[model samples]
Target: MHRVVVTGLGIKSPAGNSPAEAFATVLAGKSAAAHLPALLEAGVPVTFGCQVPDFDPDVYFPKHRRRHLDRPTQLGIAAATDALADAGTPDAGRPAGPGTAGSGTAGSGTAGSGTVRCGTYVGTGGANIGLTADFGALPHDKLPVATVPMIMPNTTAARISIRHGLQGPCLTFSCACASGSIAIGEAAMAIRYGRIDRALAGGVDSMLNPFAIASFARISALSRRNDAPQEASRPFDRDRDGFVMAEGAAFLVLEREDLALMRGARIYGEVTGFATGADASHIVQPLEDGSVAARTMLAALADARLRPEDIGHVNAHATATTYNDRAEARAISACFPAGSPPVTATKGVTGHLLGAGGAVEAVFALLCADAGLVPPTANFTGGPDADAIDVVHAAPREIERLPVVSNSFGFGGHDATLVLSPR
Candidate 1:
């Protein structure tokens, strides 16, 4: 097995548009949760979310393509463009020698010598809201238009591939909230196993629709704290009720260690191990036994040649739900009995990005690892179950270590864990 490393990252979230801005906000313990204007006006159950403040797809895309794509696809495209540009992908038509100026290199000075061998993978919960909105704009008397292309889950990845001229392994993965992280993990595996030299991996979701809110409300999954929108997503807090659904996108560039080195890329971290499994217990509820999730973590550790004690921090899948927080806490405690390393949940700030949650949280894990600080679980007041673990609350905490685990546990018992180490 070869080594896989992250060369670049791009973030478009409620906190900010750029990765640096978002990372700084996370480290500062800032919360982007606010009363959602559109939802509140529409009388949705939940009134707030970590909605992107100034996101105008037109700023990133031209007028023509914007018409066909949805909000989720637009977010994915913007994020992917930033990631690929940051990775320094070379021109499409011309594949010249080592000294050419236009040669695509992986941020490093080394010119790409071999085939581009780039692939794309995206994870999304809701796809093509803009296209759907366009349909809604038409009068009822008008004939139903073929809006089929807009809402497909794979549309985001396909659009990304088309935009970048990537012809390899173009695929999309959806594992509920863990979709994004799983995509990154799988992309890394592809490169590590020599399937591709470079890959774009990330997730995007924009479900701020009335239909989505109504469905979640019916299921009692969304917080009904319309009074205190910011405090609604109180993960690990005793007062916490439910998760706040959010919309955003995050993407990262993964490349073979050798390829990254040859391109002189500025490495953020290495993807050491990734594992996924199912509880096979329940669809809505995770297994209380947690044997499968724990094993997944252990498997990742084994694959990375690290021990439970080697991990310094964890980017938890704490979704602010009562059962999930408890089950996840028990699993972590059981896996790392020796006072499991500092655990942090950023969803309190960004809300749950559904299919994009795992990927965005993975970015937080890498950023925290690089910055040497455990980001706080924003808006967490206090809780009995939370105090049992070293959950970072209120503010970021400095920590010492190189390796960290980012866990994403989704509905349908989907559990995925990825181990990352600083470059």
Candidate 2:
């Protein structure tokens, strides 16, 4: 089987717009959660969320073209474009075929003649819910003709394919929070099987509108600590009320190891393992036993030919929910020996990005491997169960070269894990 490696990363997150910026923000233990003026003015029960500030769509898409895309699609396209550029892939408009000069190499190289088939795979939790609500509010006569295309869940992947000239498989996964991780895992598998030479895979979700916020509020899934937005998303704190809603997108450029090496690409890390499964216990709540979640982690380790001790850090799918934090803690404890790897839950700073959580957290994991530093989990106030695992807080922790695991569990019992190793 061929090896898969990450060549580029692009992120538009609450922390920052680029990978460097976002990772720096995480290292600084900054909290992006803030009060949403729109939600507050509208009298929504959940008024605080982590939103991508100062995002100018015009910078990514022209005026006429922007009208056809919803917020998620726009974010996805921008992230994908950035990933491709970072990978040193040629522009989509260029006419370069297979084996052409400057096509296979990393810096300023084309996608290696047309023979190097490229693909796009992205995931989202809610596909344009905000746009759907807007269409519903508009009069029938005023409804736009492009409503269906804009509201479709596959629009993000489709737009990414069009923008990158990806002629291979183009797919979208909607496995709730695990959507992004699953997409990235499958993309790596495609390269391993020689189905595609390269791929743009990640997740995006933008549903911060009033209707979407209200829907989550009705379900009691959002944090209501309006007076202290920054401290609202306390992943493992006993006082944790619920998760804070957030919106963002993250994309990674995955290329076959041999291809990347041949093109002299700057490899971030090797995607050595990926595994996904379901709990088969609950639709909304994870099984308290955490047995199924443990299986996912073990499977990923087995796939990577690694042992529990080989993992130096864990990027947890800690959504700051009461049950999720407890269940995930149990799962981690079950996966490794007592007091093994240091774990960090990034949602404490970025809030919960829902479907985009897995992808964005995956990026954080890779960055950790690259920098040899484990970022602290912000807003972590000690509680009774705070010592469930070796939670990294207060400051960043440095380590030698070692594998890292990133876990993502979503609604419908969807569970995914990916193991990354520094190049």
Candidate 3:
């Protein structure tokens, strides 16, 4: 395997559309959650959420293109475009063979030497299909028009490729909440294996519909903090209920270390290690043993050739749900015998973005590595059930030099952990 590094990043989160704003909000320990918009209705148990307050897709996409996309696809395209631009990825097209240097191939007859061969891997979930069914019936023509053009999981990546001139492989992964992280991990591998010179990896999801809320609420999966939206997602906190539904997208530009160096890219960090596993324990609940989770983390560390103590901080996949937080904490404690490193859950500020959660949080982890600071966890008060780990609160802490681990566990018992080292 070749060395992989993250050279560019783009995010459209609840806190802001840019990395600076998102990082500032994380450092301030502020909450982006708010009462659900009137369009969402009040019957939903979890009416409050961390939504992208004022994202105007028109700013990124033209009016003609914007009208055809849903919220999720729009966000994905926005982030992907920004990442490609940041990476200086030329719109030159794909390569023709295995060793061509053009478009990521080293083979002969590559797409074009001037252009970087690239692929896209996006993680998402079932979009607002019901909305499409409803609004799609507007009868503009005999055939029902799709209210949401990209309502399926794969469309998110497809639309991104269409928006940008990425002519390589376009793949999408839907492993529930872990979708985003897996997509990024796969993208990194694509570059590491010389499949493409550059890859765009991330997630986008907008599941704020009635059906989504009802389904989660029925399963007791959503936070019922209707009255107090900001205080809802309390990861590792005793009073934590369930995850708040949210929507957003985040993307990263991954490439081989030498290639990035040659391009003079400002590397945020290196994707040192990645591992994934399945619990096979339950459909939606994590296993008590946390065997798979621990294995995933350990495997990632092994790949990075770093000890548990080498990790200075952990970006927890704390959905604020009781079961999730406890399970993740236990896994961390088992992996790191030196009493879990200082932990922070950015989901406390950005409500669980479902498929997009892992992608958005991964960006935060990289930002932390680049800035040498760990953002505080918000909406948390002292509690007994909370993990017995140092939790940064209210203010950012300087963690100058060390590696970090970002974990993401999703439904279907999927678990993924990525180890990152400062560049």
Candidate 4:
């Protein structure tokens, strides 16, 4: 069996775009949630969310290329482009490749050109939100000139494959919030089984307009804290309201450990274990009993050959919602049995990126293992009603063990967990 390791990490996130920047920003306990005047002006009941700050598509793609690309697809392309570059993947330049500044099928994948085939796997909560509705509403003459590629669910992964010339499989996983983590896990499985040596895996999501915001608000799953956007996502807090919707993307360059070492790539951490499961009982709500969630974590631990005590920290999938935080906390307590590890619920800072949340938080988990210190949960204020977990709040804490576990439970009862350890 092959060992999988992360050679590069990239993101277009509200905290910061680059992996280092985002990790540092989260560690400093800065919440990126903010009030969107545009949404409010559009009469969106929930005006606050965690929007990517100052993101520019013009930087990732020329106007001609991005004409039909939706907001989420643009974010995905930029993230993948950056990840491949950071991994030292040869000829992986984009936003510009050759004539288009890319050929995805344009060139060979790595340095020294050893036999290698790279794959692309991405996940999304849903397809472009506004494009289809707008196109349907507009007259034929008023519609944009770009083709219908804007509405395809697999557009981001397909575009990444074509631009980088990846010959291996290009797949998209759509399991709501677990989409990104599932994509990454499946990519690791492909490498471990020798189907592919390298891959770009992650997630992307954008649902920030009135239509989507109103949908989430209608379900009462959004924090209605427009007056205090920064503190809106208070995961595991006594007064936690609900999640703050966000839009962003994150990608990681996964390659065989032997290949990465041979090529002198910077190894962030190894994906020691991964497992995904479902509650099988609810559509949006988790099994409050936490049985299924606990089993999923145990399965992941068995895959990594580690016990609960071996985990130094946990990147909890605490969306700050009433049900999710409570259910996840109960699962954590059940899984550990001995005692829960230091938990850092980052939604308190980045809000909830939906499909992209898993991949983005996975990146945070891997980096946390590499750094050997757990960042504090942004805005968490422990109190009587908070779940009984060792939530890292108030300040960051140092830890001795290096392995970290990241969890993601999506709508439709999808649950995924990854065990990452420093190289």
What are the per-residue Cα lDDT tens digits for candidate 3 across 205-284?
Answer: 87776766777899999888777888888888888889888888999888878767765778888888889999998999
Pairs of residues clashing in candidate 1: 90-104, 108-264, 181-359
Candidate 3 lands at a TM-score of 0.92
lDDT of 4 by residue, 211-290 (tens): 88998899999998888999889998888888999989999999888878866888989888999999999888899877
Off by over 4 Å in 2: 92-114
Name the weakest run of 10 consecutive residues (lDDT summed) in model 3: 102-111
> Where is model 1 poorest over a 10-residue stretch in terms of lDDT?
101-110
State every prediction's TM-score relative to the real structure.
Answer: 0.92, 0.95, 0.92, 0.93
lDDT of 1 by residue, 1-423 (tens): 669988878778877788888888877777687886777888877777788778878778889767677778888888888877776763521343544423232321222453556778888656665456656778877724536667666888988887777767888987887788889889988888877777889999988877787778887888888877777888888888889888899889888787677668788898898899898988888887577888888888888889989888999988999888878888788778788899998888888888888878877888888878898888887788776678888788999857899988888898989999986
Model 4 misplaced stretches (Cα beyond 4 Å): 90-113, 145-147, 384-387
Best by lDDT: 2
Q: Between candidates 2 and 3, which one is better according to TM-score?
A: 2
* Candidate 3 ranges beyond 4 A from true positions: 39-42, 90-115, 128-130, 133-149
Q: Which candidate tops TM-score?
A: 2
Tens digits of per-residue lDDT for model 2, 21-98 = 999989888789998888888898988899987788888888999889888888888888888888888563344555
- Which candidate, 1 or 3, would have the higher TM-score against the true structure? 1
lDDT of 4 at 130: 59
Clashes of each: 3, 9, 13, 11
Residue 420 displacement in candidate 4 (angstroms): 0.8
